[model samples]
Target: MQPRSPNTAVKFAHQVKHWRLAEDIRAFCAAARQSGAATDWTQWAENYAAAIDSLAAPLGMPPDPPAGQHDLRDYFRGDTYAHPWPFDKDGQWILADDGVDG
Candidate 1:
């Protein structure tokens, strides 16, 4: 089942901001990795099919949660089981933590 419908009031205006989209992608990928969904061909195929269907339609799937509405940190918590990724106090995703002076 679809988890939830995205906000449509912002249809004329952009809803998901760039930073949030990037973080969401990262989190989704991380969950897939931890859940072994990355290697699951069946799931991949299903997702691919759905994407294709969306592309074929004049209008694709509705936009997901906007920048402030959804948090990447919480989206995949259950699927990933463990949160290896780090986020700053402000809840922004951290790319890396190299112990080096730049």
Candidate 2:
């Protein structure tokens, strides 16, 4: 089988990080709402996207697939493990929150 391109690997890593953050934000928003805190979807989406971009930028990755391309879901659907590793399993790709992997 052909090896995945560097761009494709970078995109895959970015997608993984992006979705992880999005899920965290969604959970936080839900908890905040339950506790009567204000929640703004518009601002949240913007901030979330920006945060994802910031996290991805240092890796020299591109932004999420443009709207002109296939849908985001379509772009991600495949054997993602085929992508190359940006960092080794023991290497620090992301800092841990609780002083473990960080």
Candidate 3:
């Protein structure tokens, strides 16, 4: 087989790093849910956002990117099946409807 191009190698490395980062974020979210760590959904979202930002820092990513760049908050609000968190009128933590049925 022909040797891989330098650009191809770089892209592969980036892809691997991205995949690992996604897994780490998934695990963090899972553990956070299991732990009942934070009672406030927004606070939990902010904390998770910070955690992900720090995780991406070593990869040369900005914690909060410039305007027009993808904001980490969008990740939490994305179309993915991951349930959104919200507090009810009684202030009890709850999983907000994501508009997608199980």
Candidate 4:
């Protein structure tokens, strides 16, 4: 998947794009190992992890954590306070034909 922002995440994605192939991957790992933990690789991992863990930090994203009762109702309900909504409208999501706003 691709990162949304042109910040640390985008920079990190570009850094690893060359490692897509297996042979290049081994070489990349070797380079990281040579650099040691106190290096870009570690920072990259931390930034990537933070981007992932954040509720909406990464724009294009992985699956959302499951929502249940007692989960933030605002997450599922729009500003209109619509009930039985299947998505959190406050985020960058839109509704289906049945719920579409535009």
lDDT of the candidates, in the order given: 0.50, 0.56, 0.53, 0.49
Clashing pairs in 4: none
**Reference-based TM-score of each model:** 0.24, 0.38, 0.36, 0.20
Winner on TM-score (1 vs 2): 2
Worst 10 residues of 2 by lDDT: 64-73
lDDT of 4 by residue, 1-102 (tens): 644434557555643452344344445556677777356665565455444442334344334444443566655445434455445644444355655566
> Which ranges of candidate 4 are over 4 A from the true structure?
1-36, 54-102
- Model 1 spans > 4 angstroms off: 1-16, 39-102
Model 2 lDDT per residue over 12-67, tens place: 67678786777677677667777787557745764775677535455544543323
- Give the range where candidate 3 is weakest over 10 consecutive residues by summed lDDT: 61-70
In candidate 3, which residue ranges exceed 4 Å CA deviation? 38-102
Writing each residue's lDDT as its tens digit, candidate 1 over 1-97 gives 5335445535422323433444555567667778877766645644554443422346544655434323554655464435454555565666665
Worst 10 residues of 4 by lDDT: 53-62
Deviation of model 2 at 48, angstroms: 4.6
**What digit string (tens of lDDT, one per residue) describes model 3 on residues 11-99?**
55665666676666666776776787644673565456556443455554223212221233464546433544454445455566634
- Give the clashing pairs for model 3: none
Clashes of each: 0, 0, 0, 0
Judging by TM-score, tell me the better candidate of 2 and 4.
Answer: 2
